[model samples]
Target: MAQITLRYIPFKTDVAFLQIKQTEVSGIPLYIIFFYIHVYSAIFVLLAGFTQFNSYLLKKRPTIHRNIGRLYVFTILFFSAPSGLFIGVFANGGFYSQISFVTLSILWFYFTLKGFTSIKNQNITQHKAFMMRSFALTFSAITLRLWKIILVNLFHPAPMDVYQIIAWLGWLPNLIIIEYYLYKQSKK
Candidate 1:
């Protein structure tokens, strides 16, 4: 009986270890790799953009602001936006994911352009304000990922189903938040 018990113990231990390994390998590596890049880059841009905005607001340093803003816009407009759009299109979900990304692209363009035009017209205040909204939207990339996580855990464990809603979930909430804040600022 003791010999039989010891033999089964090793078998059980091996099976348990194999189960743990399989569970760890359950996630798709390719998706995770791209996601890591997408997430980290988006966060970097958001943090850096906010720092530049704060500097402009407090010091009113046009030179530093303009330079930083230019860098920010270039990064978002060219690199971040394009990459996001691509990932959005290839997103594990379907129509929802596509629409969400398309919306992000448009808003990013519109707000950024408005900010640029405002600056051209020598309307620094308006430019700054509009740019704030644009950058907020840009930062939505991060929010979208977060929403995807919550939705996956709560409503849809499948990436595809969650992907569908997250397309809208990502930016729409951010926009709503922007609107709400703008409204509050107006009241003040």
Candidate 2:
């Protein structure tokens, strides 16, 4: 009995490992390409935002801030959100994952548009609020990848399962952070 159980254990482990390997290998090249694009765009947006924000905080350089901010928002709105949304549709797992991606895409557009509109109307406070929200979604690519790593390590779930959790896992924390930031801003 003991020998049988041990034998099965290794078999199960090997099967699981094979499953992961198979999925990773067979997944489309487009999937990998989109994944890379999503991650790089997030990094680009974050770096641009950090640079402009730091300049504003230290030197109060409005011109530099405005120029970088334009580039930042453009990246988020035009490049990041669309690619994310496309990738979200192709996201593995199932319908809930798809819904999460769709929701994320809408929120991305909404907050970004709000920020742009607020800026046009000279509403700095609102602009900041919306920009924070937009940035939160932009950061989701990073969060999603991190969550996938964690979930897979912990549960060794299937690729679809990981993808589903990642669909929600990626952006949910970002939204929470945005709420916290907005709350802090309001407190001040």
Model 1 residue runs over 4 Å out of place are: 1-44, 55-57
Instruction: Please provide, for model 1 over 1-188, each residue's C-alpha lDDT reduced to its tens digit, 9 standing for 90 to 100.
Output: 12322333433323422243342224543433343344445655675677775754548766776776777776676666666665555554667677778668777877877887898899977887788788778767567768877887787667567767777777788788877887888798
Clash numbers, per candidate:
0, 0
**TM-score list, all predictions:** 0.68, 0.73
What would the TM-score be for candidate 1 when compared with the true structure? 0.68
Clashing pairs in 1: none
Give the per-residue lDDT digits (tens) of candidate 2, residues 86-124. 766765677999889988988997898899889999998
62: Cα error in model 2, Å: 1.7
Give the C-alpha miss distance for residue 136 in model 1, angstroms. Answer: 1.8
- Residue runs of model 2 more than 4 Å from their true location after superposition: 1-41, 55-59
How high is the lDDT of residue 171 in model 1?
77
Relative to the true structure, candidate 1 has a C-alpha RMSD (angstroms) of: 12.0
Clashing pairs in 2: none
